[model samples]
Structures are given as structure tokens and as C-alpha cells.
Target: MLTTLIYRSHICEHFPPHDLKEMVNAANLKNGQADVTGILLFNGVHFFQLLEGPEESVFNIYQRICEDSRHYNVVEVFCDFAPHRRFGKAGMELFDLREYEREEVLQSVLNRGTSKYQLIYDDRALQFFRTFVEATEKENYFEIPPADSWAFVSDDNSVQSASLPAEITTECSFAFQPIVDPLAQKTVSLEALIRTSSGEGSAAFFSGLEGDEVYKADLKSKKTAFALAGAINVGARTLSINLLPMTLVRIPEAVNFLLEEIEVNGLVPEQIIVEFTENEVISRLEEFTSAVRQLKAAGIRVAIDHFGGGFAGLSLLAQFQPERIKINRELIRDVHKSGPRQAIVRAIIQCCASLEIMVSAVGVEKPEEWMWLESAGVSHFQGHLFAAPAFEGIPAVCWPEMLSAM
Candidate 1:
């Protein structure tokens, strides 16, 4: 969970900066033991922070923070099961808003305001504290607050909870469907599928195409780009882009270029899911992991595609720590029939869940298969039952729509 602590107090005024540094160091020592990563924000007279890590670490820090003799109007601006970790490491980063030229940017963008060291506890002054932290980070820096103007921060135990929009809680249940070959009773989406360029295609379309000449030509013909453009034109919210390890090694510039296009076309990196094949990723795990880390750092979501197909170990999973893991279709195809296979898959999913990682089953085909997967605690599914990778466009549908359509 992404836990944030907004302590609105005159603690800064009460303690000297040197003493505050010592207290922050102490806090960091406690956090390191608990494996928490967060940033501390201080605006001279006030203090606020966005903490991300295990729940226990955050809670422990909150309890300690309240005891410190800093200023008193403590508030928790945001908290939630963050889609992504905000900070890379566990440390207390101090940001002084007084340094920024445009203080209004904090107020206007994040809804946080500042005041003289005296009126630190005024309710109005505390309103914009989280906003400032969020604007500086420029990410979904906080959980969506419950209301537009105010959020409740329970001081009883420093457990911070925000009031989010009602729609946020009810909207968008995401699910996946298997990709199947209608002719082959045997599923094929589990295999590592690479993008190939065909003759008469745009250079961009052929940028990373490989494999059979015919397939390469087909991919190069601007078909995929046109299809993706069309999907966005029609309001498609997310796009899945498959990348080969060779592509990262061979066409690094092209990868950056496509990422730029994705951003230019009105999609954030978070909306573009990049899938990496096992063979490709495992061959150059370090390079692949580095690339994934960079992409993730840039807010692009990464998926270790075709997981469990190759000799990938749990160590690899720990190393990359991707936001999503798509189990190789082979694992899904015969998992129900093989106890050992099922056990391994279950273990992988359980491990991922513990890390707050999302597990998606790929290449599902039958209704019974879906039911079995759901029972196995799979959070998302993708297969032919959902839709094939077509040049037509990404379908506009919800998780329930896909499920009911099946």
C-alpha cells in the first residue's frame, strides 16, 4: 500500500533544523528495518510526506512522527495500494517549497498552500500540503482524495485515509481473456510472438520486425500503427506493445522513438504495457532488467511476458520486479491436467501477490479453463476468448463485457 503522512504541526518551529535532521535520521533507521521508501516534505513551519512500502513500516513511522516535537497540525494527505512505488529507496527526502520560484504552482496544481511559521495549524493552510508534495513528484503522488476540498486524517493512531471520488471505487474492473487460434485447437498465444515487418510497410512499422519474411512485410506495412492510431481515435484507453530483447539491443533509438510516439499520441507510459519474452529476457537478463527498470522509472509499465516458459527462476522475478507478469501460455494450456505445473503456477502467483505484483494468465481458451483460473486466484486473464491480435483495432470493452461476451 502507498501510505502518505501529512503532519500539520509547528514541529519545525519547535525544534531546530539540526535536531529535526537527527529525528529524520532516526526515522530512516526505523524505516530501513521495515523496508519502507518515502519522501518527507517540509515547508519551514509545516511537514508532510508520501510514504510507499509495506504497511507496517508506514504505520510504524507515523507513530514515531507524531511523537517528535515538531509543529502540531499533522495531516495524512493520501494513502492507498499504489499502482507503483513512488520512491526507489527507503529514505527521508526533504523538499523545501520555499526554493521554487512559483509557489502558486504548488497551490494551483496540488492544492497545497503555505503560511508564516505562526499560523501553521489553521485548517485552510493545511489544505494544500499534499498538493505541493504531489505537484513536485508529478505522479499520481497521492491516493485520490475523498473530497475536493478536505480529507479526514485520524489522529487516534496516525492512520491516514483519504476520501476519493465514489466513481473511482466502482469503476473499471479489469480482466483478461485468452488468445487462441480458431483453427488450431491447441493455443499458440503463449509462444513468444515477435513483431515482424512485411514489404510495402512504413519504416516505423518495420522498425523492430523480425522472423519470417512474409510476417515481417505484413508488420511493416503501417497496418499495426494504423490500427493503434485508429484505436486511440476511437477512445481506446490502453495499448499493449510487445517488445523483443533484440529490439532493445538492436534498435535502442527506435524503442525511445516509439515511446515518444506513445506519449505524443496522448498515452502515458503507464497506459502502454510492454511485454518481454522469456528467452529474450533471460538471455540478457541484466540488459533486459535495466531496460525495464528505466521504462518503469519513466512511468511505463513492464510485463515479463512468457514467464515460466524458459528457465526463469524466482530470482529473475525478484530482480526485475515488474508490475505485471504474464504466465507463458504453455503453463496455462496444460496446468489443469498437471499437478506439478499447477503448483508451480500457483506458487508464482502467490509470490507475485505478496509483492503487490499483478498476475495475468495468458492463452486461456475454454469457459472451464477460465473458471479454474479464477478459482486459482488469478487476477487477470487474456486469450482468444478475449480477442486476437488483429489489425482492425483494440476492442473497446470492460472486464465484465469480455467475460459476459464469452
Candidate 2:
């Protein structure tokens, strides 16, 4: 099988530049013997390389390269199988970006490609080259420490019983997970995640419901969420609850119901945020927009949950701007190591920033993921890395003792 691997890394500080020539010569000789061919680009401070050859040979060569002490913050940005090589002639070629002007560097690199036709047609690989040569994505490259640098400690000892009305108490329960600013060491909000009374997920809780009943139940569950938040006395801290978009349209006076519930539970409208998933289609757009206005007028904020996971993202952003957007887990997963994901997320952050909308990342499970998102200007985060959702209670969060001095 043929394999192609593309990775980038930062050159170690105080490293001698003269040794780069000797290192390239050794790599060329070794790779030639192993029947591997690739090109490496160095832009004074960072190295981008692509290796394409037999799967076993390329894998072995990459392992050796990773162990070299000359570079740090290694991120394997792309890996895939291809029918043929793009640079079949050279064992390993080095291009120092410092020697070439930015205007001609990409074309110069393409001039070295053995498969010029493939490079022109395959924009994926070519875009990576262009991005590296232009250095447009340099700002998003965050160097995170080893995963074990910090530990995640879960403290469920402070758990308090989530009191629910007797009628709906047996029907469902709530699990509260915090959205926190790790650097600030503060909880921005606690999201009330719906679950079965025995602690099953939302899927199990709504399995038997159908049609408008699902929307009704989705709206009704918030009453229990509010009661639980009040039970825990989430004073001053924002409480975020998920809601179906249609619930606001289908249920009469839905915003008024929410406002009344907020008062009854000893909470205020400003402290509540209603999150509507972007993936769900809002069948009645006009009505939904009006309801959103009502929500805002009542001092309750609106947010688009799972922002990038669906088709309605840009259109929804244009329709009625939400106060916040939670970048979906799919985009957040492995973002630190992915050039494409990093670019997309950076665009999302920029767009939201311009409109004065806050962006948060959800389902972030790795320290690397959190680091990248934090560096990209997202301050709020939710996921198991800090604290898992507590069943019928609030889970205590574990903050990193020391962040990397980047």
C-alpha cells in the first residue's frame, strides 16, 4: 500500500542552521535506500514535510524523524493513501523558504513536483503547500506540552440532590456540567443536560416520544432543569439549557412560560441562556425569529449550539444573531494537529468576533484541543477534560495547576 504523510514542527531554539544541510543529506541517503521519496520545507523556524512511499517504509522513516531532538511541537497534519507519488524522483528534497520570495515560492515548489498534473488537480495537497509557504496559518500553531503535564480530578463529593416536581420527577432528571474559562479559573455557566431518571442519555429519555410530543417534552424538560439549578443555587452564574427551535413556535407563549419559570425557580432572565442546536431545522423561521426577539427582550440570551455541525450555520447567523456559538465537537476534535480544522475554526472565530458574538468549544477532551482553541481566541469550554457531567448534581471542576509558558 502507498501512504502519504504531511507534518509540521517548530525548529528548536538556539539550533545551528549549518547542521541542516548535513541532516538533509543523511535523510536523502537513508530514504533512497528505503525506496521513499518526499520534500521538506523549512521557513527558518518551522519545518513542513511530506513523505510518500510504501506504507511500511514511510511509517518507519516518520518514527525516526519524530525522535530527532532538532524539532518540537510536531503535528502530523495529513495522512492518506494515494495511487501514485507526487514527487517520485527525489528521495528527499529540501526547500528553504528564506531563499525564495513569497510570490514565487509556491510555484517554485510545484516546479519540483514529478506529478505536475496531479498537483494542479489535487488542490488538497497543493493548498497545504501554499498555506505553509505563505505562512498564513502560523498564528494558529500552538505548542502544547505533553498530555500528562496536567491531571483531571473529578470531585463529585459536593453533589446535592436535584429536586424535581413529583409529577415529572420520575420522568427525567438533569446533569449539570460547567462551561469554564480555564485560564481565568471561573465557571462561565453550567449546562443542564437532560437524562433519564436513572442517568441514561437524552436518546433513551425521548425514545418513546413522537411528533409534537417530542417538542412538548423538550420544552417541558426545562422546568425540571430550572428547578435543579435553583436547588443547587446557581447564583449569579449563567445557566444554559437546550431547547428545540420548534418548541418556541409550537408551544403558545413559550417565552412567557420560560420567564415565569425563571421567576418561580428564584432565577432571573438574564442568568438563563437557551441553546438551540443548529442541526435541527426550524420549520417556522418567521415565528422562531419573533420568539428569539422575545427571549432577548426578556433579558434571556440565545445561543446556537453545535454551531458547525449542520447546514444552517451561516444562514442562522444572518437571521437572528445569537449571543454565543458553541463550536461543534467534530470541528474541535484533534484541531491542534489538523491544519484544515485549524483554518476552519479560525474563520469561525473571526466571523463571530466581528459580529460581537462569543465562541465556545464543547466536547473538548484533550489538553491539546483546549490549548489550540484557547489560543485561537475561544475562552469558554465544556467537556470531560475539565469535568464530566454529574448525574442529578453539579460536578466540581479540576483546573490545570500550571499552563505552559507559551
Candidate 3:
């Protein structure tokens, strides 16, 4: 469980190159004993470094780094978990970005790590850290990604419980609703809606779930979503599934479970869009954003579910861009008949368009409602008008014949 801490700051005016190396070398000696491995990059002005080791060791080193008088205005860029150490050792590797050519520095950073993509973040971060942390809450400095993103791949189903292990099976299930694009006359993606096997609905099924139960339920549904798609050989269209952001933070293994299952089901991360609802209050915006970044880094798309339904929905988008936004039904309903609603819907479409985000108009029931929304530049839609959600698997989308006339 190696945690990575990244920060950038300005080297004080007086420190010479020789003196800086001596200091870093001395720290490297001390860090090796603490099992920390990382790279320090100084570009003559700013000092950018990454620290990786046990969670406590990394944070302790960061605290010392923050207190050190050799550098001033130290800004923490990212604190995340690395699946494996990029450098593969317990000592500081120095890179003077100023002394070397761009290729040399990049190769040094990618050494022992994959060439595909490794999280050697922000040498791009000095300016971002300068602005990003200030504009957002400073307490956010403490949130880090999980220790190991693959730690929760529990295939050993041998549960020895007081009750029969078989009795511990989850009662919750899922139904999928397809998001349609009328202009293309094609079904776009399937959104997995949670349901109860007992026919009690999502509210009743998930009512008492808290802590680990929530994570278990989410992991189960996410796995099922992947399984269903694979079983049907669904195309590259996104399989949109709802995710509880806080649950990922609470137990990062939930994320690991999903990632593992994606491989098992012969699916790629690009085909999935994890949606967080607007109804849930974002108590820890920084934590939520970090989890989203982890997902994005894994090639998974993020979306805002039932958007514009809460204050946090639109306001939070300006900070971190998502791949999709499903317009809340309340705003989409009767939009053709209501001038204010249409205006609101238009503004949302424009905002999403500006961000280059796909907009899916959810709850499009009436033909008039669908017409106005399509004219307003929205191509993605889903609701009872197309077809009601079907349990166990995706139901056929009843494409309207009116689309042919149009």
C-alpha cells in the first residue's frame, strides 16, 4: 500500500545547486529507511517532487517538507495512491528539468513505470496548485486516493457466517433504461437503474444500507451491469451506472471491485460512465473530485446524474468537467409548453456544449417535449416515452415513428 504525495514550491533565493543536492541526498538517506521512493525535480526556480511510501511515512515527510525553510510557498498538488512504485526503490532520484532536455526528463520520469501513462503529475501543477488550492478549501490537502486500487478483487466466495453463507446474498437487483438519440434514430447508452428483486423498488431495497453494505451493494450492481452488457455483447455504447461518490471514498475497494470486474467481463473502461446524482449533497467536494479523477485516470467516464436538481449540480461543474450531464426530469418536463423551462433547458444545453459535454435529456415523455428538446440541440434522451425500464437486461427501445416523419 504505497501512497504518493506530490507538491511544488519555489526554492529560496540563496540555495545553490550543490547545496540543494546535498540536502536532497541527505533526505534520501533518511527516506530509504522509511521505505519512501520518489523523484525531485527542480527547474532552477520551482521545486516539484513526488513522495511515495506507506501512508504515514509519506504524510510525515510531507509535513517536514512543508515546515522546511529552504523552500517557501509550498503548494501540495496531489496525494494519491500508486498501483505500484514508478521508481521501484526507496531513495530519491533527482531530475533538474533545467539541466536536461525534455526527452531526458520524460524518460527519467517514465523509467520502470509504464510508457502508456503513469501519474507523474504536475510539473504541470505549480500554477494550478497556486490557484487550485486557494480557490477551493485548504482542508482538502488531506484527502488521498486509496492505497491499492486492486486490493478488493475478492473472488473467494467462501463466507463462513453464523447464518448459511448462501443466505447472505444481496436482495437488490437492477433494471436498465436506454438513452436514445432521435436525430440519429439510434439508441445511445443504457443507464442501469437499481431495483429490488422483491419488486419493492430502489428506495425500499437500499433504505437500510449503510457503510460496508452500501459498498457491497454498489459493487454487486456494477459487476452485474458489466456482466449483463458482456452477456449480450453490447456494443461500444456507454453503460451508464450510478455511483455513490462518498462510498468510493469511504471504502476505495468499491472502485477496485468495479475495475476488476470490468476486466473479467471483457469490457473496457471507456464503455462505462459512472454517474453521481445531484440529489446527494456533496459534503466533501475535494474527496469527490479526487475519486472522479481516479476513475478518469482509469479511462472511465464520469457523469452527473439527474443534474440541475440541486445547487451543487451546476455549481460544481465549473470546477471539474464531467463527460455527461443528464438533465433532471423536473426541468425537462413540459419544457415545450413552459417558456421558463425551455429557457432553463437551453441555458443548460449551452453550458454543456461550451464544456464539450454530452447532454442526455432524461424523462422525455411527450412528443412535444422531445421535439422542443431536439430543436434546442439535445440529441440524447431517455424516458417512458421510449420504453419503461426493464429488469435483468436492456429492453428494446421503442423508437418513435414520428422521428421518421421528421
**Best lDDT among the predictions, by candidate number:** 2
All candidates' TM-scores? Answer: 0.44, 0.85, 0.56
Per-residue lDDT for 1-406 in model 3, tens only? Answer: 7887777666776777679878978999989989998778777766767788899998898899878878754655567776666554538877776665654555555553433334455433233332332333332222212122112121222211122222123675566777888657677888877777654577887788887787667667676667666665556877888877777777766667789988887888888889988756366678888888788889999988878888775676787788999899998886654435655777788888989999998987776677667777889999987756776566666554432222
Candidate 1 deviant stretches above 4 angstroms:
1-227, 230-236, 395-406
Off by over 4 Å in 3: 1-170, 403-406
Provide the clash count, candidate 3. Answer: 0
- Model 2 sits at a Cα RMSD from the real structure of 3.6
lDDT of 2 by residue, 210-309 (tens): 9999988888788888888887788889999998888888888788888888999899999999998886634567778887888899999999999888
Output the worst ten-in-a-row residue range by lDDT, candidate 3: 152-161
lDDT of all predictions: 0.51, 0.85, 0.69
* Tens digits of lDDT, candidate 1, 344-381: 77788789989988888877755444544665777466
CA RMSD per model (angstroms): 21.9, 3.6, 22.7
lDDT assessment of candidate 1: 0.51
Error of 2 at 51 (Å): 2.5
